[model samples]
Target: MNLFNANETKAQFILSLLPITLFFPIGIGYTGIVLFFVALLAGGQYRDKWQAIKDSPMFFPVMGLLTVTCCAGLLLERPDGFWKAFMHYQIYLVLLVFISVGAGYWQQRALRVFFAGAVLASTLLYLNAFQLLPDWSLFQNYRMYAGNKSILIGILLGIAGGWMLNQICANHGHKWLRISMWLYVAVALLFLAKTRTGSLIFVFGCALVLLRYLTFSWRSVLLVIGTVIILGVAWQTATGFRERLVGTVSDIKAFVDGGKVSADGIRLEMYRITTDIIKEHPVVGSGVGTWAIKYPERAQGLMSAEMATPHNDYLLYAAEIGAIGVCALLWIWLTQLFVAIKIGGENGMRLFTIGIAIMFGGLVNAILRDALFGIAFMILLAIPLAGISRHNYKSHFGDLDR
Candidate 1:
């Protein structure tokens, strides 16, 4: 193959592989390597994508946040942490360029690639649950043990459920296959995964699908409400589900009452400590990658082990780069939600539902802290945004239209 053709083909192949990589930590690393090659092979396309990134509504806020964080990391004189923070900035830059340059090609293939990845993840997760599969050491670190696994699997299932609903509504896929995929995702999330957060998000996403596509018939509305009530009652009866529900209450009680050290109590104490530290450097903040350093001093006496930043991303950002950083991050998030809804067209509500779940889930859990989640979120977003921009450009600015 000619060098240019080889470059284009290889770049497309790597973009297709992205969705499957979301399932494994090793895959995440491999995906990055592949993306680097894709960028290098992209050549002249890089200039076009740079312009695309410039025109993207989300570009400024996201890049701005990254720049501010890097500056904070430098100001702290954290030679150790500066590189880590810089690396994150690099990840975003690479992803933005890759997505913008490849958007037109990937948009058509993204849905198929996404579903293919879901099937692979579901199969492996099922095998792992049944102990029928041998452990691959590379993916060993990605194991979804109780809480963490639930969150990750739950997020994937939620997205899958939305995809299933989209297919069913459009009547695009096989009827039986769509029904079965939704059933599997629901079963794995509720029965096998048994995560409260995941289950809630999945249900919320499904409800949006129903409300968005289904006509607002009074009978259907009542039936949906009745079904939800019955499900709520059933959820309460499940032993594991019940324990989580009750445990949340117990944790709150422990946090408030003068109870001994508990999981919830420790988290609350850590928040209190982090808050005090934020007050110390309220304006510019303690700087990125310095969480481990600042957290130890305040949380040392209160907890047995040093705590990480608060379990929350917003709080983490506020503590790291101060409220200004928080504002910038929020701007990017809100714009993403807005853009997802706008570009998503008929399925806009569905996009909003999933996007909000990811954002809210991050607030309560450490979802955004994981590099994999950040990468996955960008992939999910870039496909749609790229298509939207491309269509608009062709319609309004391209020679034929002009």
Candidate 2:
């Protein structure tokens, strides 16, 4: 029994490291994922693990998504593309893995590890921004070192900020420290990273947390007004924030007025063309991997540049797997939100906060299509979600078996 316990402890330690690995390069993150799964296998509780997965609220919606992907792939006769897409979608299964392996106090420990990782990564980014790090070409920018886009960095920081806000709402100790951390994240995202998507997501997430925690009172109203004022002041004063906002408006205007394709304009054009494609094949889409094959043909000479994805997850999924796939995708997100609401605590708020970030991030970027962001999304989500599941299981079954 002692030997078994030691092995289990080792396995759980491996699971704990997975979230932090996401801040590193994609290869390192992938290695962590492999080690996590290996640890799960080594733990050796197949029956209980399968039961845990089945009991989770995410099971059916996730399964529906997989089924839709398969049907779309088979119907379109692109067996190769279907297989590739199927493998990509397998990342969702990590949620079930988390639900199965994470129990008792392990969930909270993993969360701390995740937050610590985010804080460390953010510090590195700041160092890179100020050129305080060792002078190396690879360390020149946060993106180069972290192997992620500026938008992704912004989203991560925004989510971290939301998590900090949740901590404050819970009335946990270290109030001032949490507030400072949240402010740090906001400054990094808005001023340093300058990601429009991140800014919007951060504001939305903070608002959601405040609304969830605050009572219906004049104080709440004043707090909301103060937030709006701060944002307004930032808009007027921050050069990066102002330029990005102005640039997006200008790009849209250029596209509408003269059909000129700039950065945002190209995405708009892609959305338009993708929508037409979806309309043509409303049932099962062009196929799982047909976007690259079909989009260029449809959009030839229509835009200045070509992209494999439409930069919108909804449109991308709709065009690839049709309306059913799109519905399944929505089901996955909506159900996750529902579960988070049902949970209703720190864990629930964490899930809700990140869920909003992912949902809003998807509007302008194919976040899940990107390797690093997709893995980060699933793992971050699974940690809190699995915590909620563990709590529910304990309440119902009275302390899960160690």
Candidate 3:
């Protein structure tokens, strides 16, 4: 059932090289395009392989989300926005299809290169943190075409954290090397970069890995709680942490007391406005690409934040496509979670870790808005899903190599 033929060799070769641009946002996008073309060229050979997707739990949910998005876009009467969403979401769906078809081969072949790329990215981010790299500042919170550095680094750190946690739980691998690497990544994230969303992901991923595999007694649980408390205390004592905490509170209070807006306050207001928009167009939302057009109408002269989408992904989608879109979106995420469950054990833990992080990121930021994070997340996610599926297939057929 080898789908890759001599005709597909060049395509696979180009696909393998896609990981080299893991750190570069634009580079990942370009590589994704190449992967898409390669996937299309080789897809005909893998008709049977592609059929395996029908057996997957995620197949329906993913397709449902895509169908809903497309329909909403078209129904909204925004052909331009519909086209834009089609291109963006269609790429993700295509990636899922490509990965599912090549599941067995990709992890073994491409994962190492991707991890190495992540390591290099980690090193570069560290250097940038220390200002060792001129003009390469590490505080990239905003979305950019190339990618958000903070978001990218945060994801890399989460992967690194998960890898290290897997090693610890398995009680194997280069223990000291991983520890050192883990510390390095943690330092870069918690102290150097100080990306709240990324740090949250790293912590969440590590916690899940440990919880999934580790045998925790009462004493161990207490120890974990103590460690978290200490970390919380330490964060409170840090100057940057204090400022962010105070700023968040001050913004909320200001908005409540005087309609004053701070950075965070603006996001709060946006959520409120977006909710109103969604309420008005609950079924078959206002339309795709009309956030900009609709947002001003809802703002009611409250603030000057000119943006198309809300800070939250769910609200953004709901506002655009209504309840159906929301259901489809949640279905997609739920399928990811269910698939991760089907892929259980250490590998499953890793995938679930990333899945939760992506979900969490969508809550606070526009997950799909950042092309780099979205593309990279899909690639990383694909490897695990493919690996798990192949492993299951082999196990089920009693064809596992002995």
Best by lDDT: 2
Predicted structure 3: lDDT = 0.63
Task: Output the TM-score of candidate 3.
Answer: 0.81
Pairs that collide, model 3 = none
Question: Model 3: residues >4 Å from true position, as ranges?
Answer: 1-20, 39-44, 136-149, 216-238, 256-259, 300-304, 387-402
Off by over 4 Å in 1: 1-9, 27-36, 39-43, 74-79, 89-91, 138-150, 170-173, 194-196, 218-238, 301-304, 344-347, 390-402
Q: What TM-score against the true fold does each predicted structure earn?
A: 0.82, 0.88, 0.81
Give me the candidate number with maximum TM-score: 2
When summed lDDT is taken over every stretch of 10 residues in candidate 3, the lowest stretch is: 393-402
Candidate 1's TM-score reads: 0.82
Writing each residue's lDDT as its tens digit, candidate 2 over 267-308 gives 878877788888888878888877777788887776523685
Candidate that beats the other on lDDT, 2 or 3, i.e. the better one: 2
Question: For residues 224-271, could you state the per-residue lDDT of candidate 1 as single tens digits?
Answer: 664476457647655675677677778777767867646644666666
- lDDT tens readout by residue for model 3, 351-387: 6887898889888777775566677777676656653
